[model samples]
Target: MNRVTAWLPDRIDRRVRVVAWLSFLAQTIIIATGGAVRLTGSGLGCPTWPLCTEGSLVTTPEMGIHGMIEFGNRLMTGVVGIVAVLVVLSIWRIRRERRDLWTLAVVVVLGIVAQAIVGGITVWTGLNPFIVGFHYVASLVLVCVTAAYLVRLDAVPGPRELAVPSWYAGLTHATTAVLAVSIVFGVLTTASGPHSGDADAGRTGYNAELLEHVHAWPGYALFVLTLVLLVGASRLRLPVRRWVVVLLLVEVVQIAVGLYQARNGLPPLAVGVHMVLAALTAATMTVLVLKLKRPTATAAPAGDAAVAASAR
Candidate 1:
């Protein structure tokens, strides 16, 4: 079994881990629900900033189920945000000189704030496709950061310094590119797609057919690139290869969801799945890249079996 992280007190570490895991899960759910809000043409479900239909948190019954669903998502985001804060505080209390842990916790808090702002911008801009797309991307990035932090805490002990080879470094760069392109296409798909609420309420002025065309081509490209990355990773020996494999699988799953979304009218379930997969893909890639750095060990001279055996 993998050793438990030493970054927390024994009495509290289990609880902290649970909170961290739940925070990650909750973030995934929020991303998925956000996709549903877009797919169902319900972006304007609330119909007012910080309020649903010029009413309190709970308003008139006529606001309908969509309003409740979207608001529920927001509520969950708040819950996840609180968990993130608690995780940070617990880390600080348990570990001495855990600068990495502290840094990530701060990042988690910042991501929550950024997500909230982007959400407000989406609403304020009346669901402008560009800003809406950005909002979704931000959520994925935030999730990626949170997941990377978690993985670092869970990784096996190794040199404190990065010790990856140049080839692995190249793979990391390529994977990052793949991640960025996939996210862009995902955003494009969401921007051109329908929103929650009335059919015409949140429509973007861009030609839906043209946007679909744009989104589809990149989707194919991203899928291809992701496959290439997996193949390329096979040629390099890297500590993060397992995570890279996980990343590729996540991308493949996302590709399936994208295809399903295109065939069907962006069903709530499919969109939610797409959103979660996208975030997972991003998180996996982030962990892979963060593991990369110049090799700290000098390469052994060729045919030095005796020395190698001794070192081993």
Candidate 2:
């Protein structure tokens, strides 16, 4: 059997990689739609826990179109949950090569379920700022972990140890951490501060401008950090993969949209686009980091030297 086909189970014929890709795509859509719910001031449109107003999926006329929009986003979470299960099961059947991938998928599914419960609590408690903030943070974390899982699954056993500067790996780790923190700060701004013209109404706990400024500073720091990582990666002379380029472009677009939203008083459409781009950037970073091979700065054994010379 070929190397790619060797990863499959005898009982299952189709590629597990395809399922993994579909799960990633589904996850991206679900994250984007969830952001839409918050951006459009529909976070509380349902106005009840685990249901729309009055415990109906579609309540009375007073619930209106906004309520339906929110509920529909909620429904999309179920689709993500289904895809997560499929990914997990497909990997489990072929557990020999990629146990970690399946394990992370299992964790992601649990995280999403817990995230849904948190969403419910946010509504039940009248959209308490702290809980809502965590809800958004949780989604970002899920994307990060899920992306890492997907990338590792697709990884080939190339050379067992490709040579790259140790500092590049460190920078990648730092960049990923900063991006995650930036995402949390974003959630804080949206949850605690006024946004979408709802701040004055006391929907969230903090004032709009103050919370926004607090959130904005982290983004500036994160942008600089990402640049450092990117430059350092380029210096290593390791092959730059397609995903890294795509991720950097997405990050640039996300930053641009964020700046526009800030200047335009947080337009809903702009914020929604920013959220999707942020998720994509986060996912792509995960892929890039996973692809990186840290240099040990040690001489190779005779067997390894022979293979390396032959490949060159």
Best by TM-score: 2
Cα lDDT of model 1 overall? 0.68
- TM-score of structure candidate 2: 0.80
* Residue pairs of candidate 2 with colliding backbone atoms: none
Report the C-alpha lDDT of model 2 over 32-67, residue by residue, as the tens digit: 777777666777778786767665766457867667
Residue 222's lDDT within candidate 1 is 58
- List, in order, the clash count of every candidate structure: 7, 0
Kindly report which residue stretches of model 2 are placed more than 4 angstroms away from their true locations once superposed.
1-15, 55-62, 156-162, 196-204, 240-244, 294-312
C-alpha lDDT of all candidate models, in order: 0.68, 0.69
Off by over 4 Å in 1: 1-12, 53-55, 94-96, 155-162, 196-204, 210-237, 293-312
Query: Residue by residue across 191-279, what tens digits does model 1's lDDT show?
Result: 66665334654545666656666666655665676666566656655566676677767767787887887789877677778778778
